[model samples]
Target: MSIFKPRRKMVVNREVQYDVLMYVGVFIVALFIVQVFTAYLFLDQVQRVVGTMSALEFIARYKISFLVYQIIPVSFSLIVGVYIFNRLTSRIAGPLFNMRRILQKARNGELETAEIKLRENDYFQEEINDINVILKRKSD
Candidate 1:
């Protein structure tokens, strides 16, 4: 089953993705802040272990390399997290946005709009099918 359908020309709301993006952005920022904090704390432990190594020496010799290694994983994970959830949330939100249009049309006595089904494998297909049944009853 497909996860995406071509959006209609009549966009009821262009900001359909805004909530997902905001949440994803917030999460990514929080994750990055935490990652940076932990990496520096780990650096402190490293410095303690080095005993005779001055902070300037440690930084000049190893700080950039260590932080790069730490940050690489965090960045990769953040990207993957945003990608996965954006796809997931979009699946739900797109249908909802389209369904709102259909339902609104039905409210104006255009029962034919209820016959429009979402794409295969799209989120909320079953619930929409039930809504179609209700629309059929209302039309009758």
Candidate 2:
């Protein structure tokens, strides 16, 4: 059996934390985008009303265009952030959950319980291995 094992017990907690953080970050970014867009629209409307396409108007127009340019990147960031957070939490939580299930099975005198192998880069590899060691000892 490998030291790295998949986990499954902590699915709920990890997912909750990830969801909360992703929602909060997305909300803040969306709010900022709305505010900037609103300001640009307001200034553009004012300039239009005055019919003065002066330097200030030009600058506003350019900056508004720049903001538009940034929108795609910001949207990309939001999407990527949500995806990465979800993936990270799922990876971590999945292993714990699987390990928990194996432990429970072992407790019921399942000597041939499946081994809990963790990912090499997984954060909880050591813990899972230690637990496995303890189980092995108990089984013997």
**Shift in Å, residue 8, candidate 2:** 27
Off by over 4 Å in 1: 1-52, 110-113
In model 1, pairs of residues that clash are none
User: Against the true structure, whose TM-score is highest?
Assistant: 1
> Lowest-scoring 10 consecutive residues by lDDT in candidate 2?
10-19
- The worst-scoring run of ten residues by lDDT in candidate 1 lies at 11-20
Per-residue lDDT of candidate 2, residues 1-140 (tens digit): 98989876665445456666676787678758766776676566556545657778766667765566567656776786678667766767878887988988887877574567777555466677888888777766
RMSD of each: 11.1, 11.9
lDDT of 1 by residue, 1-140 (tens): 77998877774334445655676787778778868776776777676557787778877878776877678768777787878787767777778888898889898876663664787756677777888888888777
- Per-candidate TM equals 0.57, 0.51
